[model samples]
Target: MQAFTNADMSDKGATKPGFAISAWPDTRDILARLYDLANKEPVLAIKREQMERYLGYFEHKCIKSKSMTSAAMELIPGGVQHNLAFNHPFPLAIKKAEAAYLWDVDGNRYIDFLQAGGPTVLGSNYAPVQEKVIELIRECGPVTGLFHEYELKLAEIINHYMPSVEVFRMLATGTEAVMGAIRAARTFTGKAKVIKMGGAYHGWSDQMVFGMRIPGIGALESHGIPAGCYEHTQECFPNDIEALAAMLKNNEAQGGTAAVILEPLGPESGTRPVIYEFNACVRKLCDEYGTLLIFDEVVTGFRMGLGGAQGFFGVKPDLTVFGKCVAGGYPAAGGVGGRRDVMQCFAAGLQGLKKRAMVGGTLSANPLSCAAGYFSIKAMAETDAPIKAGKAGDRLTAGLKEIIKRRDLPFVAFNHGSICHLETAAAMLMDINNPKIFTEVSERKHVMEEMGAAFTAEGIISLAGSRLYTSMADSDAVIDDALDRFDRVLGSVEKKK
Candidate 1:
């Protein structure tokens, strides 16, 4: 892999030394290519025969997994507890995970590029973090509905890395953290409305669910939830600074905007990459509007580097949301950290003067989670795991690009450090205004699902066949092997007629 130099860093932002992302992607170039792919007729997809063969892998080779998921479907909705577990055919029952790999219940091995939905940057079931977590569990157990020393230690480490996070409060999941952040924002700013970049998922929280995955389709997936849930939640398209400014300006007449929350890298973990200067520009806008800026770093916090995205972008958000990697891939892994004044709104117990956000979780900041997070972060810093993982992402992305070019495929591949994206169908890029938008999106999505199954049959596990998260565990040899597998799947592609 190539070593990142200052020349490769984004000139528009100040990336701290040893941060994960070496080169900020050219957003205009990527968006242009994505739009072209989306607008292309007869979506290029894996051949029908090839797809059937790939599906056969689950039917024949993964009999145990199929049986297990079949039984689970009777009990669990969608046959899987998590969205990431769903696949084209069925969910595979993963029995074991180690650095860079997973073994299904059927005993089949796979190169784990999903990385537990972008949490395991040091890689799956990292031994160092696992060992510490086990030790803590054996000693004091997971949680006690009380305080733990590790909580303070973890918060200290986080503050050391992310100075913008002057105070921290742990939560059980990303959803809870997002809720807390929004409540705190409303309380601190004394404003009701919050604006999020469209298609950027802060979590499954009601307010954040507006315009999810695809921009401009507001409340399309908000079934069962009341219309009033997201009434104050407004969305603007990614990288559209002018639209965001106009929305902010408009919000002034409607009781003002409380906060502007976003994923600094762009929506869906850079699936829609943002311009290099986007974060700084948003910061300026927030400052101008007197609105709190919340950085949803659930996927980018420690994984992006210990300093987090705010540090890389050199734009300090008023609050930063943490999840996934916060507890070293352990359960109950999420938190919100920010300026002291705002975070005080989440202060536990009764307070006379200050208005509190009223956030609580019985298992939050458990001893096990805090211990695991502290150890994991220490190991990450000691080993420069983020930089190593980023190099692996760069290598994988470069290899995929080469294969795409050689095969003359209209696929687009890019990476933000360890978070790699390979858009085969551009399903998420479909325009909402098109008359047949739903039909087109569904067809393109099916193609993407087929591509995912193809990759899985080739012994690779990717996120929706489009996203792949590299880690410190993915060595040059590991990445090369995975590339060959990806090539095999891509080789079966055919333009749909």
Candidate 2:
């Protein structure tokens, strides 16, 4: 074995002190063209060891993310299910996701700001929902398209809370519900065309995939999307009442418009904030023109609390599409809830069990999903979980805001209840020293890579370049822990300056 002294290694190991970076603006750009001199493969089995090593030197530690990411690519396609999870190296693989934290396979824990992208609003493996699921599964049946008590229970729960829902039905996914909402609206109004907000993501269904954002710019599709299939979904910008009004008028004149759909609070529009006046104005227009307005609440539904986003904002829509929080972080759940007149179209065919609507999923209203959803909502109401989660979101984001401000860093953050996220375009703009110069899509992407690695090292798992959600299970202590780690990792990103 060889033993080395500080002076010996310092003299021979690295370049002399005060070596300048020559003017590299971003750490990512530098990392991009650089290669390691040593074999990093040895680092793979040593993460748990590395974490211990760091903790020995300091009181805190986290995963490197690089090793875990490479491992993920071998197991899962793109290293994740959600589109935003396709970060630079690749997303870290989860060993476990419980409560408000994720443990990567490398054994590093992260405060789960991603919150399973929102379905885990109550947090992963919530006790009440889990208990209910197990109890129901053992006692009776988990799936029965014939009918189940939980489905009706689920319907009544939704009807009791949302003002717009007089009658409703459930499905297995948000896209199913959203597409059903569109189909029902057209059937009820006898119209063939629909309008959708630009940059809003309803689902992966072909019809609704039109006009999505590609690095903050609206396009028919990014890749693997057919222009012809999405042609009927006329795109309008969020919060742009004028553009909306014009589109509605033109469609009405053309006599083909049936419905208008949007994410009530879209995170994809590059943080274009929605105002009270704008939503209220939209409601008035919907009523005046007899156009059915659909609030695609996949990200907002139970997440905005018992009343969801419509009630939270004091603006009700004719039809509402829900998912995410409804399933309590489980598989198979979503639904369309709304006015009796529109829903009646779906109710038409059943005798005692008539089916008026064309939407049907073998898993639609399955007992398993219904039981999960019922328990999720009940848990929120009973524990005041939504409010608690919102507070968590507020604290986490507020801390992040303070850190950015104190560091004089540029970034934007906004929250819709417990769901919160950061947009790093401002951060990139600041780094470029000119907001105007942060124009390229590639610049924003480069920044995402840096943030992902930094957050992973800080014991926090975030989404995309800049997005996160607070779960009800995150108490103040958990929030503080994440914030402290965030503070340190951000400092590291800066030191790499």
RMSD of each: 4.3, 15.0
lDDT of 2 by residue, 96-125 (tens): 878987786567767888777778877888
**Residue range 1-497, candidate 1, lDDT tens digits:** 11222233243544458798887767777888998888865588777798888888989999999999999999999899999999988999999999999999999999999999988889899887888888888888887878899999999999999999999999989889989999999999999999998888888988888989888989999998899999999989888777788888889999999999999888999888878877777787888888999999999998888898887888899999999988888888899999999999888777887787898888898898889888988899999999999999999999999999999888999998899999989998876765667778888898899899999999999999899999999999999999999999999888554
Worst 10-residue lDDT window for candidate 2 reads 35-44
* TM-score to native of every candidate shown: 0.96, 0.80
The alpha-carbon lDDT assigned to residue 318 of candidate 2 equals: 88
Sequence-dependent TM-score of model 2:
0.80
Quantify all predictions' global Cα lDDT against the true fold: 0.88, 0.66
RMSD of 2: 15.0
How far residue 378's Cα lies from its native spot in candidate 1, in Å, is 0.8
Best by lDDT: 1
